[model samples]
Target chain A: MGRTSDAREKILGAAHSLIELRGYSALGVAEICRTAGVPKGSFYYFFESKEALALAVIDDQWATQRSDWTRVLKSDAQPLQRLRQLFEETEAEQLAGQQNCGTVSGCLFGNLTLEMSNQTEAVRTRLQEIFDAQVDMVDTVITEALARGEVTVSDTRAAARSVVAQLEGQVLFAKLYNNASQLGALWTNCLALLGADSPHVPTAA
Target chain B: MGRTSDAREKILGAAHSLIELRGYSALGVAEICRTAGVPKGSFYYFFESKEALALAVIDDQWATQRSDWTRVLKSDAQPLQRLRQLFEETEAEQLAGQQNCGTVSGCLFGNLTLEMSNQTEAVRTRLQEIFDAQVDMVDTVITEALARGEVTVSDTRAAARSVVAQLEGQVLFAKLYNNASQLGALWTNCLALLGADSPHVPTAA
Candidate 1:
């Protein structure tokens, strides 16, 4: 029983890594099994099919990511400071890991939404819910910053979406160049745009 | 001679449509031949290999896009206004087309950067050159805007990179959602960040 459970964990770990590397659409069950050092038969014993395994992987990654982001966003620091720290930490993680998925793989939920969500409404709806929740989380933090006059924007919701969009773009750029400098550049630009040191110059130009 | 030329055009057209609908990696020569109503022999006659055909498709599409964006950006209007118009027209085009490759299939250049470019330095260098040229174009336009006092930024180079990054993110989002609305949303958000007037804000979010 112990050995079988260990193999199952190993298979999941391998699938998660491969999916991150090549994308969920490009990965195959056989490849995951091989990478996990498990027999093909063992794959079936653990997961019903490749899609099932992928869904499982998505769920696992989503939970971990939410926990990490929540911890950072809810820290004792000021909301604006917390947001900046979140982005800074994210930039550092991407730099150190040479991986852009967690920060930018365009949201694994967003990715699955494009790949299989249309084919399966259940998946589509689930991903939408998750994404909407994430947007709301950022919205709350940004709103707090606004109330405190730490950040100023014409529209808080739109600003939140732009922040997400910019982060997503930086991730894609990082993946394209296989470097994290673009991510750092994005953080620096975003900070300047929102920094308290700079007065909100609505008509600076 | 006429019949042979017609057949070749059909093959290329079919290959382009299929690649945009599915994906380059998921498509096969046999499928392209079938869709085009041409035989396997004729496909070989028209193109040396799948890679050759893909490269041809890329070249054709890139030329068309270059002309389209250049015309929009170089219009007889304010530099910032012209940039906003370009984005508006792009939003319209995305909504009007079916199975569009512009945002969905991704910038063929950006997509190839993620896939083939990593394996082949030749392809990588070609994509880099294309992207660098794109940045230069954007920089010129943005710098013009800055000179006109239409927009302000601490770093023009980083802002240029950010614009390209946002465009890439929009494409990925469009492809994932299979909805042009997301592209429009991204465009509107971008315009707001650049301090342009956008009529796309939802009445209720």
Candidate 2:
């Protein structure tokens, strides 16, 4: 049982890294198994197909990211500050990824959304739900900021979508230039998007 | 001579559509050749490698989009209105793509940026140049807007990056949801990012 579980994790980890560094369509199960140091048979035992494994990878990354998002967005900090924290932490995470991998990997979900969404209905629906949930979280924060008279927006949901869309776009730049600092604009950009006042200097991480 | 030129154009057209529909790595020369209805020998005659072919595709697409961008961004229209026209036209283009292909094939450059940036230096350098040119064009408009006091931005270049970045982000959503309307927020988001006043209704397209 221990050995079987170990093989499963090894395969998942290998798929995750490969998909992160490259992308979904370019991968093969044999290579994934080879990288995982497990036999090909173990892959079939774990994931029914490469698409299934890609879905699993998406699920796992979202689980980790969602936890991070909830922690920051739900904290007791003022709603505006919470949003700032989200941007700062996002930049930090991308920077950390750059240091580890020699390139900023951007958001895995955003990456997969562009590369896989049109090709697979299953991936498309899953990504839509994930993004919907992200917008929901950001919308809640914007509503809070609106109530406190800290921001003004005619439509909170649309504001949140713009903010999240801006983040994804900036992250795309970060990955293209291999410079994580491109994301530093998100804080000010978000404030502007929401019609909030210019930001205070973010508290240092 | 005319027949030979036709064959080359055929290969280029087929590769462009295939890459736009799928992506770079998942394609093979043989499949592209078959789709092009050209002999594999013809592909070798026109392109040196798959990467070289991708560069040609990138160049061809950019040439067309640059013309469109220049026409809109350099027009005598009010500076901010030019930006609004850019967004409206972008959404229209995506909508047209969805109607033709049953999918909102996104900015071909952005699709490649997320999927191909880290994998190939030649492709990466080419994409970087393309995006830099995009920012430069947008910077010119933002600078014009700032001069007129129509938009307020601390740094016009950074502001241009934010605006372009927002467009890229929103386009990513439009593609994922297969809905071009996701891009309608771009003009408003751009105004917010530039610290401009709430918009007057954009003149009808």
Candidate 3:
């Protein structure tokens, strides 16, 4: 049982890494199996199909990210400080990935959403849930900041969504330019969106 | 000569549509040829390969978009109004695509950037060029706004990039959720980014 579970973890890890390096449709099961050092039989034993594997990968990635982000949001620091830390860590991670791969690979959720959302319903729906959950988390953080008078935004929901979108867009740009430095403005621009750095008029939420 | 030109246009049109519906990596030359109603021989005659075809597609798409955006930026309205109109038109266009396809497809250049940037050098370089040209256009528009005293920002370049990133991120979310309405916030958020609705400090340019 232990060996079987170990094989499953290995396959998932390999699948995630390969799909990260390449787009979803461009990778094949054979390559994943080879990279995992698992035979074809073991691959199917763990994942019913490639799509099944992808679903698991999405869940796994989102679970890890959610925990990490939740930890940041739940931290004792000021909400604004926590938000800045989140984006700063994001930049550092991308920079590190660029160092390893010679180019920044954008967020897996965003990448998968763009690549597979239109083509696969299951994946698309799951990606949407992941994104919505992420936005909700941000919304909660913003709401907390507002309660504390740490940030001033007319619309917390819009502010949260815009912040997430800007980060994703910056990551996309960073990846497109093949320069992790393109994300240098992410933190500052996000703050601007939240009305953290300046006074803002209250608009209809 | 006219027949050859017609065939080329058909191929380019089909390739663009297929790619927009699917993605860069998911579509194959054979499928493109079938959709275009062109033969394999004709496809080869017109474009050297799929990569070459993709380059042409990028150029063709950018040229069309550039003309439209230039007209918007050059319009007789206030610079800020022109910017608002640009974003409104974007949302309208995206909604139209969603109406036709039942899913929001986001920006083609951005979708391609997320899908192909790390995978293909030729496509990635072209995407970077396309994105840079877009930012330059936005920068020009913002500069014109500054000269006219319609908006205030410290760094026109950073402002331009942030606006573009926010819009792209909104589109990505719209597509992810299969909800064209996700872009509803694009215009408002964009105004906020430009400091149009609020006075902004001039940061380091």
Candidate 4:
């Protein structure tokens, strides 16, 4: 049982890294097993299919990200300040990723959304839920800001979606340019998207 | 000679559609040729490699999209109005895409950026140039709006990048939800990004 779980963890770790580096379509089961240093049989023992493995990767990555997001977004910082920190940490994470891998791998979920969402129903439904939850989290922050009268937007839900969309969009640029600094705009842009008044501009920094 | 060029066009057409449908990595020369109704020999004759074919498709797609953007952006319409028109056209185009295909395919450049940018330097540089040009065009419009006292943004270039970023972000959602209506918030969002007054809100509709 110990060795069996080790093989499963190995496969998951390898698959996650490969997926981040090369995307979903370009990867093959043989290649994944080779990268994991596991036998093909072990792969089958762990994942019934590549798609199932991808679902596992999505779940695994989101599990960690959701925890980080919850901690930062649900922190005691002011609502806007929390949003600002999210972008700061996002930029830092992408920067760290570039330094480690020599290229910004971009958001794994965003990459999968573009590459596999159209082709697979399971991936699509899962990505949709993940993004929905992300927006829901941001919505909670924006609602807090709204109640405090820190923002001007009346539709907090749409505002949250727009904020997440901007992050996804700028992250696309960061990936395209291989420059994590491209994401620095997210905080300022987020402020604009939420229609916050100039009084909060200095606090944003 | 005529037959050779015909085969090239067929391959390009098929590859474009297939790339739009299933993405680049999932496709192979054999499948592209089969879909194009061309002999594999013809593919070799016209293109040196799959990468070359992809470049051709990128150029072809950009040429058409660039023309459309130039026409709308450089037109005689008021600057803000042109931006509004651009978003409207984008929404219509996405909706039309959904009608034609069962799913929304999102932006080709965006899809490619997230999927291939980290893996291929060639694709990365090409997509960068494309997005740079896109931001440049939007910058011109935003600058015009600024001069007319129509928008309040102090940094037209950053604002332009933000606008395009918002478009890409919203389009990602559109594709994820497979619902074009998700793009409807673009005009309002764009206005907010520009710090425009409430005056343009009526015109945005």
Give the per-residue lDDT of model 4 (tens digit) for B8-75.
99999999999999999999999999999999989989899998898899999999999999999999
Q: Candidate 1's residue-wise lDDT over B6-38, tens digit each? A: 888898888877765554555788999899998
lDDT of 3 by residue, A1-205 (tens): 9999998999999998888888888888999999999888998898888999999999999999999899987798987778878888888888999999888888999998888899889999899788778888888888898898766777787788888988898899888887787777876676666665544422111
Write model 2 residue lDDT over B115-139, tens digit each, in one string: 9999998999999999999999999
lDDT of 2 at A203: 11
Q: What is the fnat score of candidate 1?
A: 0.16
Question: What do the candidate models score in CA lDDT, each in turn?
Answer: 0.64, 0.89, 0.82, 0.91
* Model 2 superposed RMSD (Cα): 2.7
Backbone clashes per model, in order?
Answer: 0, 0, 0, 0
Chain B of candidate 1 vs. true chain B, TM: 0.81
Better of 2 and 4 by DockQ: 4
**TM-score of chain B, per candidate?**
0.81, 0.96, 0.91, 0.96
**Native-vs-model 2 lDDT?**
0.89
- In model 3, what lDDT does residue A19 have? 85
Q: What share of the true interface contacts does each candidate keep?
A: 0.16, 0.56, 0.56, 0.63
* Candidate of highest DockQ: 4
Q: TM-score for every candidate vs. truth?
A: 0.83, 0.97, 0.93, 0.97
TM-score-wise, the better of 1 and 3 is 3
Question: What does the TM-score come to for chain B in model 2?
Answer: 0.96
DockQ of candidate 3 is: 0.46
Q: Would you list the clashing residue pairs of candidate 4?
A: none
Candidates' RMSD to native: 4.3, 2.7, 3.9, 1.9
TM-score of 2: 0.97
Residue A199 C-alpha lDDT in model 4: 43
Q: What interface-residue Cα RMSD does candidate 4 give after superposition?
A: 3.4
